[model samples]
Target chain A: DAGITQSPRHKVTETGTPVTLRCHQTENHRYMYWYRQDPGHGLRLIHYSYGVKDTDKGEVSDGYSVSRSKTEDFLLTLESATSSQTSVYFCATSTGITLQETQYFGPGTRLLVL
Target chain B: ELKVEQNPLFLSMQEGKNYTIYCNYSTTSDRLYWYRQDPGKSLESLFVLLSNGAVKQEGRLMASLDTKARLSTLHITAAVHDLSATYFCAVDSWETSGSRLTFGEGTQLTVNP
Candidate 1:
């Protein structure tokens, strides 16, 4: 509802297959983040982008890659999906580095690899 | 690397009870944030504390931060059933990028009538 949208709300892919999740925002926020939520691990940041084409790794960046070719679009790709990568993914965007600034989150995309 | 920890990983209380959740970080941070999440849902922002002794409250929940001690607390007053959910605290390190946040494991609270 905050202008951030995640595509493929739910997807089931076989192990060893490639998967790509899309996050689009209309807010023109400079910072974008991709996080994964698991049952016991809470929310873990996978990757984040500060500006278009400028991205960095997070605490849990293994096995995931992110691309922000444009201001409004960020893509997360799983080269070869594994069962351990199954979780709900969330995308968030904000204006700048100030933590006090609120971040807008998208509805989350659930992925299951079997 | 900064680590954030939350106390009483899980909590259960009845209606109208008062309780507080604690968050401790390993390193000094100028900014701390509190977030709530329901089962199978994304995080919802609760409070953001920017400096030492910063306090903010909304409805029945109150939050405070002590940057000097590297700690933050979320207190619930006269809790209700609707307040049941998981709460998390994150720290933004001074050297780290502004978009990066190190999150605590989270405190799951269950409120019953």
Candidate 2:
């Protein structure tokens, strides 16, 4: 298993409040991804960083943002939490010359917006 | 747009039975991945198939990919209670070096005694 950890394992915040989740890795993987898992929706990509400061929006990037200033950390922030945004967030890391490599995941962060 | 779909969204099987889960993708891709997730837990990767007719097996589970049909299958042989979990399949294109994976809606499996 890759050494990936997500801080604030669980959180509950009111709607309209700003929230941030942190994903830290010790494997020094070049690729980091953030995804939100909802019931019946599977895992939707939020944002991903290919390298330090090189990131891109994913399928579900409308309400989220991410940053990767260092090789081992990627952060996902919600500007204003909404009830629909409540879901389990996961962080994954993969490293290889190609994207075909298998991705390793962190435990997960459960968030609830009331 | 890429879409990955899994069939039998929910399955309940008795222990020692056999079942197969199917995954289909909308577009062409270079690889497919199978992952298992326990309730409230993170995903654990099970297989990575890169080409058509590629097959891999671990324990009681076997996975095969048919790129021509854009389909993948995960077969459980003699299921056990401990095999209960949600399984997901993800596909990725071959265009970029760090392309993201588009995941399918997971298939939740429950193994009963």
Could you give the fnat of all candidates in order? 0.57, 0.68
* Global lDDT of each candidate: 0.89, 0.92
lDDT of 1 by residue, A1-114 (tens): 458999999999999999999999998899899999886676788999988998999889999999999999999999999999999999998888454686667889999999
Interface RMSD of 1: 1.7
The runs of at least 3 residues in candidate 1 whose Cα sits more than 4 Å from the true structure, single-residue gaps closed, are A97-99, B94-97
Position A63, candidate 1: lDDT: 92
RMSD (Cα, Å) for all candidates, in order, is 1.4, 1.2
Q: Best lDDT goes to which candidate?
A: 2
Tens digits of per-residue lDDT, candidate 1, B1-113, equal 77888997999999999999999999878888899988877788999888899999999999999888888999999999999999998887543455567889899999999
Model 1, residue A102: displacement in angstroms? 2.9
lDDT of 2 by residue, A1-114 (tens): 799999899999999999999999999899999999998888988889889999988889998989899999999999999999999999999985653479999999999999
TM-score of chain B of each: 0.95, 0.96
